[model samples]
Target: MDFKVQLLQRKSKIDKVIGEVFKDKNGLQKTVIEAMEYSIKAGGKRLRPVLLLEVCNILDGDIDYAMPFALAMEMIHTYSLIHDDLPAMDNDDYRRGKLTNHKVYGEGIAILAGDGLLNLAFETMLDSINNDPKLCNRGIKAMQIISKASGINGMIGGQVVDLEWEGKKIDIETLDFIHKHKTSALIEASINAGAILGGAEENQYLELQNYGRCIGLAFQIVDDILDEIGDEEKLGKKVGSDKSNEKSTYPSLYGIEKSKEIVSGLIENSLKSLEIFKEKAEFLRSLAKYLEVRDH
Candidate 1:
């Protein structure tokens, strides 16, 4: 199958799983459910979950067992986005071509919605584990990987650095720290979690970690590039917010051409790390290439 078709197939599966969440919810707490549903259902690439599943597939892992983890990872990702777009953060009004959570649901509800999603993500994972005692060890390990990635040592820590350095003359080291923690951490966790669930060897796990890191950094670099020059319509969000907010980005520090070069290098490194998987990694190779040229 073509790469796009394969990607859409995985995305469709994920969407179906996510769509079933809170569907029958009602009563006084329904508003918060609506707020949570609104953000998660808003369309985007679903890259994190897709990565988890694809890695599981490559390692011949049980997709049924992995499904809950995929959903949980996406929930965590969506919650982060909801919080990231708050008035105190980036203060954005649009995401995935729709009104942001805070814009329609109000900030207080939006915050609760984000928190709700975060808690529910762990709930989903734990539910899956409790229902299948056989999967306890691997499931727990996968959950730990995701938890640390989104915790203070990972995404939140990176966010703090990014927020603190806004408009400051930051050096390359600081910029690298922000990118590695804020963006690359979760991406790495997704791949690593999948590898663990799939029973990968130590070497395979390490190589996939390298691949994840390269592509994760490249993903953010492309994001920075698009924010500078991409079409708002295609991106489904306002462009140039990074500039207005004075966020330190790859393009801001290295210039567009240089940033493109850096992305190319990262993509190359990612591909090289996948060489051991050979034909099995075709989808991931194509994904890395797509990241280099995508507008959104």
Candidate 2:
């Protein structure tokens, strides 16, 4: 199948899983539930979950067994976006061309919504494990990886540094550190969780980790490039916010051309790391290439 066709098929499966997880319309705390659904349903690429499923497929693992982890990864990712767009954080009013959670719902409600999603993510993961005892260890490992990636040493820690350094002159090292943790950490978790649950070997696991890290960094670099050059209509958000906030980015540290070069290098490195998996990794390798040049 063509890559786009395969991507669409995978997206369909992911959407089905998401629907299954959130299907119950009748529940307690209807408002909170509604808010949670609103955030989750707001369309994004669903890239993390897609990565989870793809990695599992590559490892010859069961997609059915991976669905729960895939859903959980998306929940975690959405929660982070909710928090990242808070008034105290990025303070943005738009995401994916829709009102940010805080902008549509009050900030307090948005915060609660993000909190609710995070707690629910854990609940969802546990439920998945309950359904299959054999996967408990794998699930546990997935949980650990996600927790570490989303916690202080990972996303949140990077956010703190990003917030602290706003409008301040920062070196390239610090800028890389901020993005690697804030953005790349969760991305790494996404791919790594899939690899682990897919029963990747120790050497393969390490290669995926390296691949994830490189793509994670490249993802942010492309994001920075888009902020500078992409159309607001295509991006679903305002362009130049990074400059408006004086945030340190690759484009800020290096010129746009140099940043593009850097992103290309990272993408090359990411593809190189997949040599161990050969044909099994073709989709992921293509994904890295697509991410580097995607319009949104």
Candidate 3:
């Protein structure tokens, strides 16, 4: 199948799983649930979870065993977006071409919605372990990796540094730190978690770690490039928000052409790390190239 068709197929499966889990619960807080539903249901590329499933499939693991992890990753990602758009953070009023969660649901409800989703994600992940006792160890390890990636040492820490350093004219070292922690950490976690669940050997796991690290960095570079020259209609969000927010971006540090070069180099390095997998990693290699030229 073509790459776009494959992506859409994976995304469709993820969406169905997320939607089934996000259904209205009886006697729950309606408004918070509504906000969570809205935010999660918002259109996204579904890159993180799709990548997770692809890695699992590549390693010969059952995709069904990876679905809960995929669902949890998406929830964690959506929660981060909701919080990122709150009054104190990026303070954006629109996401994916619609009112942001905080805008339509109010800040308090939106915060609660984010919290709710975060907690529910863990719940779903932990519950998934019971289905097959034999896979419990891998499930536990995957959950740990996911949690740490989104926790204080990872995404939250990066967000903290980003806010502190915004408009500070930081050096490349600091800029790279922000990108690695804020963006790359979760992507790395997604790939590693899938590998662990799929029972990757120690050497293969190391190679995937390297591959994921490169892709994560390259992914942010692509985002920076898109911010400079992407169509709003295609992105489904305002362009140049990074500039307005005074966020340090690759394009800001290195001009557009240089940024593109950096992304290409990163993709090349990522592919090299995957050479050990040979034909098994074709999807991952294609994904890296796709990121280099993605419009949105």
In order, candidate lDDTs are 0.91, 0.88, 0.89
Give all TM-scores, in the order shown: 0.97, 0.97, 0.97
Candidate 1 vs candidate 2: the lDDT winner is 1
For residues 76-97, could you state the per-residue lDDT of candidate 1 as single tens digits?
Answer: 8899999999999878888888
Model 3 scores a C-alpha lDDT of 0.89
Q: Give a tens-digit lDDT track for model 3, residues 1-296.
A: 79888778888988888889857666657778888999999899888998888888889997888899988898999999999989898788998898999889899999999999899889888888988888999999999999999998899888899888867778899888888988999999999999998889998899999999999999988988898799999998889878887767889888999998988899999999899999999889889899888998
Cα RMSD of predicted structure 2: 1.2
When 2 and 3 are scored with lDDT, the better candidate is: 3
Best first by lDDT, ranked: 1, 3, 2
RMSD, every candidate, angstroms = 1.1, 1.2, 1.2
Off by over 4 Å in 1: none
Q: Which residue pairs in candidate 3 collide?
A: none
- The segments of candidate 3 whose C-alpha lies over 4 angstroms from its true place after superposition are none
RMSD versus native structure for model 3:
1.2
* Local accuracy of candidate 2 as per-residue lDDT tens digits, 259-282: 999999999999999998988888
- Cα lDDT for residue 263, model 3? 88
